[model samples]
Target: MHAWIIWLPVCEAGRTFGMDSLGGWMFWIVCVCFSVWENAALKVNMRESSLEVVRGDSVILPCSFYTSSRLSTLNIIWTLARSSSPETPIQVIVYDYGQVIEDPSLIGRVAFTGLPLSADIILNYTRLSDAGTYRCMVNNLPEKADPGIGELELSVLEPPSLPDCKWDGDINLGGSVRLSCSVAEGVPTPDIRWEKVNPEEIPLPINMEGDFSGSVQIVNVSSQTSGLYRCSATNIL
Candidate 1:
């Protein structure tokens, strides 16, 4: 009868464990297994789940994790999806395991501020495309259930643009006339209004092409309507 003996390394303080007597290949295999077990016991932490920001600004996505055991190699992975579904294609933002790899999708615009425990990411010069949901996942298998999320809704707001005023018909007695107003560009689509320059009971407003253009029909044109007309364009931020 033959007896075989095996030497196993002891892992304490919740850190990856290996033996110096063994070669590097054997050390890594043991390390991976310890990592998987430790990850299962980890707990996740999150600060904020929703955020709102304006265009051309900066925003932060917060996520965090804690474990009693120490990890020799920690991987902080951030992915983007339309919602909180795992089926969606993940846009990798920051991946740190043994090496640090930055996804091209970030394009130098995304930065990782949370170090070691936190996986928060900051986006600079935000645009309309940035509006959506994101998920933060850790390499903690078995323990990894639902990932932390950061959902942001971006609004692009700008003041009303240059306005144009026109009339439906010429000024005449006992004739119907409509004042049309419009603007070239507006963020929330400007609201057009018509007011008598001198101020009087003008006809009720009727929108033409959306609220960008509006007109009011004067049933009976008279000298009282002879006042100059002013058109103003305003938008909701």
Candidate 2:
């Protein structure tokens, strides 16, 4: 619905009167005369409130609207605010009547999945940078909607790369050594796990300390600490 507000010089001065009987009466009259409410008939809703997809994948953002307005007057706009700069919105696409206009930066990679009848759109070759909030706004002019905007949160997942394991310092008995494990890249950063790989699958030595940051230290290493070690990295899909 729409609420139109108008300001008059007298209204501003009335506030200084401290809401006395006369001031209160004038305020009520001004509100009743200057503020008007018009009921809206349009309705917009999002089909999927949120979505998650892997990097390099294609994803569809769904939006729908119902209005008694004619098709010739319908206008739909799609905008996005990337997670990096959430306050700055970039127009992704616009459907004015029957013509479709796409943002230059996303041209050839984005297209309307369902046009004219729906506001759904598809994004191809999704990247980690594409993770953000998307908005769909529909306007039918004279018939304002209570909520003409729908929002969807998009997340792009990246799996951890193959981990590289190495050691610093000597592995000899009574010597100190630092075992390091790392992945080239990963979204949400992968967790690193280090384990001693012995024939009997024995427990790790008490002198060994491991860290999720991909490092393990063994102080005063002994026979118990001398064995093959494995490092594994994992992250959410």
Candidate 3:
């Protein structure tokens, strides 16, 4: 009976060891798979964070990373890849590994002025011809890391100037004449006003058209109405 009890306990111990061995192997396999997956994911994430900018104005593109705190030694890069053509490169705007990479096209134009986790890149003096999609790339980071991308749309507008005023109708005696005042190409629209310098000093009949065009008519033209008519236009900055 003593030998029988001892054999039963030995059998139970063997079974427990076998199960534990299997569990340990499975755990190791899972850990290895997760490590590989995490590296790949970080690589992808770094590639996704890269971005671009326009020519005439300023643009801020963010490039950041999220990974284990121990991997903070990773590098960051920002490049301007031409739209639709990745092989033909325009310029490397910024490449910040431990320090910043200086490129001629981005001289005094690009700046990286934010923390590593939240990078704020500023590009100034954007132009209309610089309108295109840009690719911002962050490289040499961990796998599964995605780089940031930004698209900029730039528009250039020439400021409005004072337009020439001319008499649209014949200025005749005893007949009404229409003097039109106009200004071209303003954002907020220009102000138009007409002033009559005559003996009567009466306000001329003024009709405005869409903030830019204005017409003033002098009725019952006489020698007394023979005075200088002035049309003034002021643009809104």
Candidate 4:
């Protein structure tokens, strides 16, 4: 934020005043223009405010800042509100006067990946415990401006676990069959699919009923329907 100011001074009279004339009063018009930097503080920006990465993978939290001061005077700090303590943020890393100080817990798992005026960082070997909120702070000395801050929410994904498949029905020719599948645990609910996989690999008998959530039903089974079936569950990590 900025403001402009104009100063205008008018003389008291056209004639110059002397020591005895009008009590030595003299004035002249003076014009001046200046700017006031009231809100010229640093600004921080994030390319992506929220991000997700698979467990064990590396991810980058992007951050940048704008400031009128020199980059050499910049100081950066990154903090995390880990899952264990959502309300309390711990300092993860700091960049001060060309030196870096990292937290012991993140000494080997995190790295600064940005240049001057940027706070981008990468987290390596991510884990479910790493999912949390992160903050990036930057300040330039001698500016007396507010520090630039950016925030990001991180999510470490867990892949779908193995699925359990079962069937309930008699082997009789006219018996109805219900094939069901389920995944006991996964970060995101896995998608379930059933497919016929035997006897020349033909498609599942038509008119099958059931939703993708995990089950399929076949009515009036026949010898032609006899085959191997498979159930699969999957989700992106």
Please report the candidate that would top TM-score against the real structure: 2
lDDT, candidate 1, at 47:
69
Clashing pairs in 1: 14-69, 14-70
Worst 10 residues of 2 by lDDT: 203-212
Which window of ten consecutive residues has the lowest lDDT sum in model 4?
26-35
The 0-to-1 C-alpha lDDT of every candidate, in the order given, reads 0.65, 0.81, 0.55, 0.75
- Distance from true position, residue 155, model 1, in Å? 4.4
Cα miss at 120, model 1 (Å)? 1.4
lDDT accuracy of residue 218 in candidate 2: 86
**Angstrom error at residue 134, model 4:** 1.7
Off by over 4 Å in 2: 1-40, 200-212
Q: Estimate each model's TM-score.
A: 0.60, 0.75, 0.44, 0.60
Better of 1 and 2 by TM-score: 2
Candidate 2 per-residue lDDT, tens place, 28-74, comes to 76666544424437889998999998999999999999886677888
What is candidate 3's lDDT per residue for 127-205, written digit by digit as tens? 4333344555544444434433433322333344576677755557778766777777544356677777555445666
> Please, what are the lDDT tens digits per residue for candidate 4 over residues 17-75?
44444322321211111123444678788789899898889999898888887778788
Question: By summed lDDT, which 10 consecutive residues of candidate 3 come out lowest?
Answer: 1-10
Using TM-score as the measure, name the better of candidate 2 and candidate 4.
Answer: 2
Q: What CA RMSD would you report for each candidate?
A: 10.6, 11.7, 10.5, 7.5
